[model samples]
Target: MAYTSLYRRYRPDTFRDVIGQEHIVRTLVNQIKSGNIGHAYLFTGTRGTGKTSVAKIFSRAVNCLHPVDGSPCGKCEVCLELALSGNFDILEIDAASNNSVDQIRELTDKINFPPTIGRYKVYIVDEVHMLSKSAHNALLKTLEEPPEHAIFILATTEVHAIPATILSRCLRFDFRLVPTSAIAARIRFIFDEIGVEYEEQAVNMIAAAGQGSVRDALSIADMCVSFCAGNVTYDGVMEVLGTSDPVKLVGFVGNILSGNVDEALKTVAEMCDSGKSMAILASDVAALLRNAIYVKTCETAAEILSLPEEQCAALRALGEKHSVQKMLSVLKTMTATEGEFRYSTQHRILFESAVISAATEAPAAGTTAKERELEQKIAQLERKVQALAKPGFKSAPAKEDAVQVWARVASELQKKGAAFIALAATEAEVESDGGVFRVKVGSSSCMKILTDKSNRDLLNEAFSSVCGQKLVIEEVKKLDEDKSLPYITSMFGKYLEIK
Candidate 1:
């Protein structure tokens, strides 16, 4: 016999054999047993969730000559023929390929004839929503009232794409995505049956990576088995998935929470060099941050995370080191950067920038270790500056001939149309510390003129020449409430000028 894939080889033979979707399987089995089967059945769900598989089993049960309770007796001639030779009455059509009106019309005409061997003529149309509008309309009347010997089973991943008229006549059954635990159990059973040795963490990783799809889980497991060559390990799965190592990712998080920017950036660059896709890396970073946030708020460990025990223990330690607010902020940055990466030409640049930017964002509202370090540094710097000053030199340093200096600087600045002077003082106070000068602009209109970089540079150079010190000039933002009346008076003054 030819080799068959694991999913097909282990396909559910009966309702009892089905994993997950117990409610749906039970309802279907009971309907078949009670002879309450509908003319048209619509099965909808995500891909690889067993919609079509259940449809096939239901069709066989309904047509089996020697049925066993609610299931088909696989030994029966009708069931065996249908399963092996593909019975004429039990027709399976791919609506995606034969979606034209002509094909549907031919199918509708064929439905008028009775079953050749089975009790009912069953038409299983997979991906039924792919049918064109005309094709759907052509089948609508037939679907609403088909022959007594005919049954239509429509299966689709997208139910909304099918018209309401076509959907109204059918009994809809929604198949859910198999849960992680259920999928993992099935995989574990299969691995054991195949005599494959695998790590528990590897199975759990594959299950979670599947995202609630049994087929996806199986596909990933298959890849792991082949790559490991008998021993399915978590490291093998990670290598195949090209995902950042959980250990390295946790270490990266620790470095970040400890405010080790250099180490964090280095790790990020290393990940990029390892050919890890930025999008996947960002997703992993976001997941790690989310777990940290959960741990910080919930104060629960091991029991909360569904991963292997060792991984959960490491995440719990990280949760203690980082605040919930900080983790949430990091998650937001990663998520936002993931969106930008869609059209980004320089994803590495974008990812690096996002990481650096996240490092500078505010932490939780409480005091943190990073804040304590900054405060300590600021205090030390303040003491150093205090020590540098002469003892008891508290009085304001001698006001240099600032009045004379400003007059000269003011003349130089005036040449550049900055006709302004300090408002607080006639001259500036200068010493080894720095220069402090106040400008008096009799008219607020000249604020922009004095603030211009060119004029500011001229004044600074003129002052430095006279006072022998380098200085920085800062412009104060005048309060709106303090200047609102002046603007009102200016408007009236403009009116006077016009008059």
Candidate 2:
């Protein structure tokens, strides 16, 4: 016998054999059992989620002379013919190749005829979304009122591309990606049944790499079976799949959190040296970061992290130490660099740069506790300063308007050698108590600079000497809503009203 790939060899013969889409399986099986099969059916989902497989099984179940509870007996002539030979009644068309209107019209012309040998003539159109506009229109009419003996099953990974008119004519069933645990268990069983020895970790690593595609996982396992000479190991599978080392990813994340740029770069360099694609590694890291963020925010091992119990606990602890925003920050950095890594000649350098941006960058506003507290403090100071500048800002002059206040702040900042900080603090209010003058800086960056001990003291001494009294320093944050400025020249006009 010729060699068959693992996916084909282990193809589900019955609904019970299909993994990770139980709800869909149950409904289709029930339909077959009740003799309520629809003429037009659509199976839509990502690749390798069993869309094609389910369609084949459904065909066999409907045509089988002896179907055992909605399952093909596999012994009947119809089941045998459908599974082995090219049955005229069950035509599997590659819509990708025959996507033109002529091919569709031909298909429509044949649909009116009765099944030559079976109860129903099934037209399995894989990747039906590839059909052109005219082709869609041609098929739409037939699909709207398919013959009694005709059944249409359209499958596509991209459903949105299919027109609503075409979608409306069929009974659509969506297939979800099979879960990792289920895939891993199935892989383990397949290996054992084939008398191949494999490690549990190796199985898990394969399952994770599969990304919820059972066919893809099986294909990978097939490669592993051959590479390891029927005795699969983690190292052999990783080498075959060209996947990044989990240990390297773990170390890379740790180095980033500890702010060790050099160490992180070294790990990235090693992965590059191992002949691993930086783009692949970056993607895996991003996924791991997402999981960590989920673990951190949810704090429930059972619901969030998919790792083993011990691994989940470790991830939960890491999540507790880092804020969700921080995790998201890192995740975004990795995501942004994924495309860069794909295009970069110096991948190591690009990966390192991405890591640095993620680790040190501040979390988004209102996300972290520390950031929110700082933001609140800055906001309160801004409100106070703005109130001072409004018409009834104080109902008393006491000397400076917005201009003089700004000038005082600029001069003090200059004296303190904080030129940049002072330059940015272009707008502010100055209040005088005897010889002491207080500056309410108008910008967050300016306020940050003013809060520095060196700048604060310098501003106090400079303003105090000018006023001939000790000056006190104060900072106010800028506000989001702009207030109308009440000019000191029109002060009396506003003041009388204020009184």
Candidate 3:
């Protein structure tokens, strides 16, 4: 027999077989059993969460002669026929390939035909979002009012691209990413059925790598199975997955934490010589820092870390040696430079420089970590100064609604050209720290308009309406070009000249 990939071979054929999606399965099964199934259904979620599989199973259930607990009985004539690829009753369309209006019209032409082998003609359109605008228009009427004998199941990873008209006509089911525990359980089940010897540690590694995709987990597990030669071990899994060795990861983080610049670069060189990817190395360090943060804060560190017992324990031990601020600095660097290292021909220089910069620099007390890091590097190159609070750095505000409030303030600032200033300041470091709106302008001209004493009260009134408080506005100037649009500039110029 030819080898079928693990994900395909162990694909869930029934609701009972689906992992980590109990909520969706229960609702769907209930609907199927109650015979309250709608004519059109929308299944949306991230890839590998079983949207497509559930669509297939649901198609079978609707047409099956005998459904067991809302799932198709594979033995029934209708179910058996639908299981085959050439079944006329069930049509699986890849909307990605056939996304034009003509294709949609052709499929709609078949809508009047009742199932040749079953009571209903089931159309499963995968990646339904790929349908063009005209194709969507063609689908709207049919989807909203398909014949009694026709059932449409549209699946999409991105439901947002789908028009609201189409959304309103169908029953929408959003799928969540399969959790790690569910993935691990499924992997264990697959390995047992295959009679493959595997360690618990090895299984967890694959599950974590899947990052909440059952399909992804199975693919990694399949690779591990072939690589392990019947006996899967933790080291074998890590090697195949390109995850750094636990010991090396610990050493790399430890060197960075201790500010041993020499040792850190040496470790990077060694890893590179060993053929490990720079991107993976950076990612590993970032993940390690994240797990360390969890270890320090969360009471259930082991439950949260997702690493093997030994590695998790090691992180816990190391957590006591680091502060959250220090870890954040390292994390900021690793994450910021991950993309750079991925594309840089001089990966070694970028990796070393980023780490060295992160280690040597101490971010200001209130600056954003990401922004502050860039500023720190620029400061080093040009020897400029980092500015402190201008006598009154406003204290912390209520919380998350600051952006919404600031937007209102900008709207109110329109009369005084503060609106143009606000729009122009978009590219600058405009942020709300505390209840204060810190508006940094790239152009000095924009800065003058925002900071003009006349516009202050207008901004204050806007803040009052949204926040129920008259907040402060802090202005700073930075290097940037003329950001004002030509139309806005003309309008503002005319208004100012009249005033």
**Of the candidates shown, which would achieve the greatest lDDT relative to the real structure?**
3
Tens-place lDDT digits, model 1, residues 172-272: 99887676677788899999999999988789888766755677778888888889999999889898777778889999877766667899999988988
Better of 2 and 3 by TM-score: 3
Residues 39-89, candidate 2: write the lDDT tens digits. Answer: 899899878889999998898888888888898898987777777655567
> 240, model 1: CA deviation in Å?
1.4
Worst 10 residues of 2 by lDDT: 483-492
Top-TM-score candidate index: 3
The number of clashing residue pairs in each candidate reads: 7, 4, 3
- Which 10 consecutive positions of candidate 3 have the poorest summed lDDT? 384-393
Error of 3 at 145 (Å): 1.4
Higher-scoring candidate on lDDT, 1 or 3: 3
lDDT of each: 0.66, 0.67, 0.68
True lDDT of residue 85, candidate 2 = 57
- Evaluated at residue 323, the lDDT of candidate 1 is 60
Off by over 4 Å in 2: 99-110, 260-284, 298-314, 328-499
